[model samples]
Target: DANGTTWIYKPREKTAVMSRIPLLPYPMILLEKYERDAELRATGKLLPVPSNQKMNAYLKEIADICNIPKNLTTHVARHTFACLAVEYGMPIDVLAKILGHSNTNMTRHYTKFSEQLIGREMRKMNEQMFSDDVFLLNQ
Candidate 1:
């Protein structure tokens, strides 16, 4: 954030670190909207929500209302972000940095590869090498 960009910081003593990366346009816009709506400029805190357990309980209730089968929690949202980032070809090192991991090895714990992602990467590589004539095994 030293470069005049907005950043989200984790201030807990255990993980007292902040990301150096700048927010992308859409997220930055959302943050601006939240700041204005919540009048958080003075306090610099995003939300005045209750405990994490209470938040998770509310999330579960909302999930049930929405017919989501899986349990909804903060950790699940983080893992979902990691999975989608991997699937979309974000470099591991970049992802690690964005995730506030000291190293890729630590970040690897969050990455769970699926067969579909592997197949997609293989097909993409084949197509890049051989154009439309590329032939790879069925996914």
Candidate 2:
């Protein structure tokens, strides 16, 4: 028996790695699993999981149906997760591991610091260094 949390991600000829998906999408994942099983039962063979290209096409159709103006793709979701995870105080090293990056440098490419974050950090630095309660000592 093993933890049901992770599955290997094999991208073509690249290295396969075990990845954990956040539980926020647990319901959707369960639904997909149910549908996949049903599909297999209905047919002799299982339908392969949709490719990224097909999934993107489906996303575009969904966006059109929902009257969403922006182009929706898997990449957009990954970028959103990268930004939000960093903004929510997840450490860079931790995030790199979560993202399956071999090094922090790969994760850095995915992470973009928002202007709001920059301003917030700057304000924090300013308060810490120059607040009235803080004594500035030249060493």
lDDT of 2 by residue, 13-60 (tens): 244666654444665566467665766767644344588999999999
Model 1 alpha-carbon miss at residue 127, Å = 3.4
Where does the lowest 10-residue lDDT sum fall in candidate 1? 6-15
User: What's the C-alpha lDDT at position 99 in model 2?
Assistant: 78
- Report the backbone clash tally of model 1: 0
Lowest summed lDDT across 10 adjacent residues in model 2 is found at 5-14
State the displacement of the C-alpha of residue 30, model 2, in Å, after optimal TM-score superposition.
Answer: 4.2
Q: Which pairs of residues clash in candidate 2, taking residues 3 or more apart in a chain or in different chains?
A: none
For residues 39-114, write the lDDT of model 1, one tens digit per residue.
Answer: 5666766655568799889989999999999999977887888888998889889989888888899778888888
Which portions of model 2 show Cα errors greater than 4 Å?
1-13, 21-49, 66-69, 127-134, 137-139
Top-scoring candidate (TM-score): 1
Task: Give all TM-scores, in the order shown.
Answer: 0.71, 0.62
